[model samples]
Target: MTPANARLARLRGGIPAVEVGARGIESVARNAGCTRLRAIVISGLTPTEIIKHVFNAEPDIMSPFAMTLSQAYERRLLENGGASLLTAYREKGHLATSEVKISSVADHAPGGGVLARQRRELETQRLLDMKHAGNPLAPNLILNPRLPLALVGVTHAIELDYMVASDDARSYRVGVIKSYADRGGKTDKADIRAACREAAVGTLALRQHLESRGDDPDLAGDRIDMVLRAPGSFVPRLFASMRAESEMASLVRTLSTAPADLDEVEQLVPAGTSFADPRVINQIPNNYRSNCKEHCALWERCRAQALAAGQPIILGDAAAEQLAAAGSITRALDLLDGRGRPPDNRAEAALATELRAAALLLDRIANG
Candidate 1:
């Protein structure tokens, strides 16, 4: 086997197996284009308390502001007519008091534990079945609905914040409540993209479940209703309706193909290996980038390795690309110092000339 594949195999064996959930889906979607990140996640080496204390501390994604805003938004939705407002916004019409029925699965599952999660899942399925069966008593608005998604060898229960039916009651749209605020008609583009990606995963899971039950998958629409705070107030409003067909297709492909990749990597795992062994972890290759600090638990280790190896990537992507031909930062420094052999290629010769000119300018300035 190739050296890289062998290292990946060792990494796969070292980490414990973990089940992917709604948050996992968001992580995958956020880094959809990063193959190394995807491989790391598939290997099941996530951030843990031990790792956090050992390695550099990762910035918390959930801040106090975010937490407070989310709690307030949910509370307003429950206490006020937020549900009806969202339904009307989604359906693009007025919702009558008689037509809007709100139900909550969160109340049945009070405490946070495995048992609570299971209860919520069961209740969500029961309500969904009733709604699909056209039961008059079925709720039109469901809070904290958990939907199941069967993957290659595992199943994921994705819990959504809200699920509201369309005006005709023939279809349902996923509602994602985010803490990001909307200023006028604009919101943070990156935040919106991330929220939409998460919504896509939920929509796909719901659609697949409906198809499995012999119901119309189209009942789960592709559009996601994003609920965000108003321009200056904490009042929730429907900010954007994003179509997630492309994002959903991308996630489906990832879920379908990830297992095959893992299986191939698993073939090279040694017997009785575990990530708790620091030797095994050190043997694994590191893919370091500037953004690694934002999401990776092993960013410090990876960054140190990159610096020790004199890899130009420690300087960031653009600098790395420009200095690719130099092979290493040490070699680039040697070239700059005019201590290396004559440039063998046009690109290297041009780089040498530029470095000499810049060095000369710096010398003149320093002398003055």
Candidate 2:
């Protein structure tokens, strides 16, 4: 590896696999099904000394803004007895805004470190226990409550923006605050989907935690609230409740089948291999797709590798599917130019015919 490549590899490998707090769970959920997850797992398992580098972390651009909006919304809910947010809730007549009491865990054990995290966990559990015991003082809305989760043998904690009590106080709902704007009942579908997935994971973690405590898991309902910015302003608005039962089930299935440790992945590399070495990274298999650019740090390397190998996937998924029979871009061009024979398969022959026709049309247009 060249000096520049080695430095880049070290920079990428230096990022902690699991960030502290809720961002950790969000990162894991976002990177699922991508090569980034594999890199994250490897980073976590590898010794830090092997991947040492002095680097300043970039400031998070979105989460802080979202958190600020959420905090402001929370304040609004507290003011005037949550009159502004009452209409956002689907339930009606069974409860009143004035009747709801809001509490926050944001200030409890603030800051990073093992001791602070332990304190936050203990405080969250204590509050949940109170709510379960039907304590009248238990607030209807719990903000920034940290819930524990275990994924692939690694323990993580997810801090939900809000855990609101049901009208009857028999259950709670998960809430996620996002900065994406919702205009005229419309928002980015991808953003909505991502938020829903995050909320589902948070709900699942809360449900599992309740179950572990011998409480009714149903206490954590499937309903999730997405707090999004209003159409024309930064003001937060609660969108309609989304049911995440299917999403939760899908994640549950994924978790059950995933490897429990790095043993399986570690076998792919030679003993004592350091991911800080660009050569070692190249040896690992990667499934490169256009979307991988959004989530994977290794996207550039993977795309270059795919291009070098003449893999059709570098052209995008739809194009790759269409050219699947050709197997490679070079072979596809060869077939189109009549320099290579099509395979005996009917699909390949049909594809070749279509490619040849397209090439002829392009040539005629160019000549004209």
Q: Give all TM-scores, in the order shown.
A: 0.73, 0.76
> Once model 1 is optimally superposed onto the true structure by TM-score, how far is the C-alpha of residue 260 displaced, in angstroms?
3.6
Predicted structure with the largest lDDT when compared to the true one: 1
Q: What tens-digit string does per-residue lDDT give for candidate 2 at 1-368?
A: 55533432444454443333443344345545544344444334222222232112232133576668656756665345444455455354334656566665766687878688778778878887878878777766776778787665555576776777743576567777776677754666756767887788788878877898899888787778777767667455676457877667656664554343444444554665545555666766666777655434445666898999999988888889999988899988877776856565887788889998888899899998
Q: State, as a TM-score between 0 and 1, how close model 2 is to the true structure.
A: 0.76
In candidate 1, where is summed lDDT lowest over 10 consecutive residues?
Answer: 47-56
The Cα local distance difference test for each model comes to 0.67, 0.64
Report the alpha-carbon TM-score of model 1 versus the true structure.
Answer: 0.73
Report clash pairs, candidate 2: none
Q: Which tens-of-lDDT digit does each residue in 52-99 have in candidate 1? A: 432335534556876787877667765443454455464654344466
